[model samples]
Target: MLEQKHMALLEEAERRAIAPTDNIRACFELLALTGAIDRDCAVRLARHRLSEGKFVLLFLLHDKPDGLSPHELAERAGVTRATITGLLDGLERDGFIARRGGLEDRRKIAVALTEVGRQMARELFSEHTQWVASLFEGFTADERKTLHELLQRIWRNLDAGKQQTGQTADARA
Candidate 1:
């Protein structure tokens, strides 16, 4: 009762459906692929955010309105305070960010992006949008929509599974 194309797609989906070890490997592989892409993009963008700075800032700011101190940023980013110190220096020098002395504790330095930095962040975000658009360029609108929904569901299921198991899906790896 199914069309040939539909049957073929179903078969392919079955073939590629997340299996035991493949799930962990696939996640790691995806991270690796993204790492490679980020490495290349860092050079192309000449931006630290494209490389590592943005991720550090994002994680720190995710739960707080005020940005993280340099020490906090370095800790979250898994770098030394000295490294963050230099990174902040470069960022501030480029007019991409501004730092303020802590209100109650002047010893602490709070870091945040300036207007120019936010604009750069917007531009970086657009780069991702463009990349995603190009990735699905061959897909129809319906297919793209379906794929997005399916991926979201898969991610949710994976997170739920991890929570329940208390072990990484890495056992399958």
Candidate 2:
């Protein structure tokens, strides 16, 4: 169910022969929902002086006490090494993380969370879990499972389209 304004826009597009099909409308709604979620998440992180990238880095480091290399982090985060480097710089400056020689390979560097970072991750994970769970509060367990399956189907469709078009995941970037 779209908002009144969105419905009106869709109707207008159809009237003008813009061909606003059901698939397009569904895509639009998905984008709008994701945008709202992103905004809300940003606001929540802002309260703790953290960005999404920094939070993700902290979350990853929190689970792996031994830490990860910059390349590994970038791959896991689905970001570029340069992006990870920038995030690490800010986290290190804020005393949230430290870069030290790798345990097994002294030549390589590992990014580990500081004690402060660990504490922050613990606190944020608690609040974040609750907030995320709240988003699906209206759905029953079966509905949640169905939604997950539907979302996975949509993702597969997207992947198929990308493959057919010879477009890599990072092409949009």
lDDT (C-alpha, whole model) for all candidates? 0.66, 0.90
- Kindly report which residue stretches of model 2 are placed more than 4 angstroms away from their true locations once superposed: 1-12, 18-22, 159-173
The deviation in Å at residue 67 for candidate 1 is: 3.2
| Candidate 1 lDDT tens digits, 48-144 | 4344565345445444445678878888888888888887787777777788887778888888777777666666667756865675578998998
Pairs of residues at least 3 apart in sequence or in different chains that clash in candidate 1: none
Error of 2 at 43 (Å): 0.8
- Compute the lDDT for candidate 1: 0.66
CA lDDT, candidate 2, residue 121:
98
- The worst-scoring run of ten residues by lDDT in candidate 2 lies at 1-10
- Writing each residue's lDDT as its tens digit, candidate 2 over 99-130 gives 99999999999999999999999999999999
